[model samples]
Target: MTRSLIIAAKCIAFTCLLLAVVGVSLWSASRRVPKFYEHALTQQLPADELAEAADQLEQEVLDLQSEIQSQETWEVIFTSEQINAWLAADLEQKFPQLLPTGVSEPRVAIEDGLAKVACRYTSPKFSTVFSLELDSFLTETTNEFAIRIAKARAGALPVPLKRFFDQITARAEEANLSVLWTQQEDSPVALVKLPTNLDDVRSDVVIEVIEIEEGQIRIAGRVVPGVELQSMPQQPRFADASQPR
Candidate 1:
């Protein structure tokens, strides 16, 4: 009986040791888990990095928004009629001689600011090359010079041309449009006195080669101002027949 009791006590002791070992292992594991979690949390980004990330994202968004705003802001568009008017005005002002006489009405249409123009000439006048010169002088060259030339050309001496140019110059100035002349260095072939009004001016005003080097006269006012502008009307269908003399 004593032996059996002793075996039972040994069994109980072994069980108690196992329970103590298990308790110690659980405590060690618990301590390790907290340390590991602390290290992991330390490696994670802090508040400042999060703020930087937010700032970077905000900057990107702002840049995109700015780009969109700029595009919309520059979207001002011009109609075809307005563009054609500008071209016609420019042509009249720039190359008074090169511009065809009968181009009073220009048919204009615009698709996306690209001008499509069809103009009717009073008579089959100047050569195609001369007309092209007029077109180039208006749109391709420095428009500022054209303005000055327009102003200067009105004061020209070649009777009819002089009057025509003068009219255009006055019209431009009255409309608050101004031009600058670069050809001032080239002495004028003839000196045309300025007339205050279009009616007082002679119809003819071309620069005759007076004294090629000296720039002396047969002088007429550079431009003959104002006449046809009042006369030309926009008509839907125009007859192609020339007026009988």
Candidate 2:
């Protein structure tokens, strides 16, 4: 072939190859984008989908970043997906369990300018048995050891069960669930505080639950005004931090 013709053919081939690469890149990008709700597609997407979207989002973000750097018109950039990731991480860390203080699973919902988490909690068990009639059993231990054994084994142990519901205000505050509070429409997600009537009062002092912050649950109320509270920074010497060795 002639030199010019060969050069032209090579140029055409290179152009076709470049076009193919561009087409493939754009196709890949489009595939990564979710077709669901703009917000969910960005934030609450399932794991695999979120990963794909994240890849695409990262590329787009890089492109946008460059554009912003050069153009100077687009100064601010905030994405729902980014916000969701942060929230998910925080929630996972704070509310890792579903019992004692949290619901089965964290349900995300928004209402009236607040992000409402419809979490559930069941009060811990508290049973006080004044007497199990151990005296009767003790008196006849030898006479009817076999009968007593049979009775204890076959019969239901009298629990004298007493159960009731109570609020989980203590755990909620400790998890910093209050700090994330925000009015609905403030962002892609916000916190809605669940109503709780928890008290810090004891027999000796009158303290009411005021607010929750940091690692401490706040209590503000009359305490006999000048009544000294024995400092308990360190619990009594016999306290156990965990199970008995």
Candidate 3:
């Protein structure tokens, strides 16, 4: 081979080796679940108790099916605490690596009509700490809910969350997390969104948060028919402050 071709081949080989090393490093980082994560999974209800409750729910549904009319609306209530417990359990089981190494487990709450998410983000070097509150409106859809963080407060300063989410997107991609978060538009107020691809579980699921109060959250959904609540495709969903179209 000529000198130029030899140098080109070496460059390609080196590039491939570098990519392989980086891929292995990221895979290793993702495999070691944090020791503290075990605590999050311990809140699941006992199996026998859960089975009994399910049986009761099935019986009640049978009774309702025999007695109730077609247009009746039924709602289920989940307390903020109960929601948080379930959220913690889910993260520990499915997305433990979504929580970065230096950050604490995320906390989710609902106050008024907004969903509040707070976490302490420590720098990788462990030198600086940031307390961040992501405040968003939890819009409801048929299959899943959409969360748009309208504003984020880092300590005392309120800032647009797009940049913070951009950083998270970089890290999450690097760590191979299951969820994808993207800022759909260039505007500062554009929504950071994710598609809840949940077609396998429920064909038509409607989970809408109807009320948010001090300790309770009420969600209304149809369990009978037309369960096609697929998460809407991620698009430009939020309106800019200057252009509310």
Candidate 4:
């Protein structure tokens, strides 16, 4: 073969080897990164194990209950799968009204920093689809969780989620859910007031939604100094409400 042809063949071989190495490196990197949601669920405690954990948690809480009557700070964490399962259960029971009249068996999932809700509603005349992506956070004020819509759609049309804020607030009020909500920046947010009822009022407790990460949320609650958690009448409330007055 000509000298030029020989050099060209050598260059081709070198390029092929370089490509193979890069491909292997990419594959290895992908495998090293964890699949957040799937991994979290896979590590979830089984039914019997979860029950034992819950029992242990309850006992611990009861043991410390008396000592915690005074000011104290506490943090609670729940795995994504556990929380999502509870949310699905709660949607079926506690928030039945959340489903439209014709909708049945709605499904809800909390993961990847958003709550995905889906349901089907049908009527004699027509049918519709309801879907929403929601993200929640806490304002500087204690005891308030603010929910914001990331996206919403209904039956071949895009819906302005913020437009539905008042309706949601009204519905929540009518349902006596003990929540106050309004529109902010053309978006709707619901604030769940703590110390829900007059009779349950206790010490100056400040509970807030602190952080929302890929597979979990962190809630931090604290009691102000010099106050008995069980005796305080009203917990401090968030003022902004993330809405226009």
| Superposed Cα deviation of residue 182, candidate 3 (Å) | 11
Model 3 segments more than 4 A misplaced: 1-76, 83-95, 124-150, 166-203, 208-210, 223-245
lDDT of 2 by residue, 1-245 (tens): 69999999999999999999997765454333111223332447676655554455456546644543344232223243533443444445664663444223223232222222222222343221111111101111111110010111001122211111013224556754331211112111112132222233222222223332322122233332213433312122212212111
For residues 7-53, write the lDDT of model 4, one tens digit per residue: 99999999999999987765454333123323434565666665555
Better of 2 and 4 by lDDT: 4
Off by over 4 Å in 2: 1-44, 49-95, 98-102, 119-166, 172-245
Higher-scoring candidate on TM-score, 1 or 3 = 3
Q: Count the backbone clashes (under 3 Å) in each candidate.
A: 27, 5, 5, 3
Taking the tens digit of each residue's C-alpha lDDT, what string does model 1 give over 1-245?
99999999999999999999997765444233222223323443455653454345445445534433333211122333333434444445655665446654333432221222334334443211101101101212211112112111111111123334456546556656553222222321111222223232344222211110111111111222236323423221212211111
- What do the candidate models score in CA lDDT, each in turn? 0.33, 0.32, 0.46, 0.57
User: How do all models score by TM-score?
Assistant: 0.21, 0.21, 0.42, 0.52
Instruction: For candidate 3, write residues 70-186 as lDDT tens digits.
Output: 333446555545555544445556667766676665555556565555555566442222333233334322232333444455443444554465576566456443223433233
Q: Every model's Cα RMSD, please?
A: 37.7, 29.1, 14.1, 13.7
97, model 1: CA deviation in Å?
24
lDDT of 2 at 81: 50
Task: Determine the C-alpha RMSD for candidate 3 after optimal superposition of all C-alphas.
Answer: 14.1
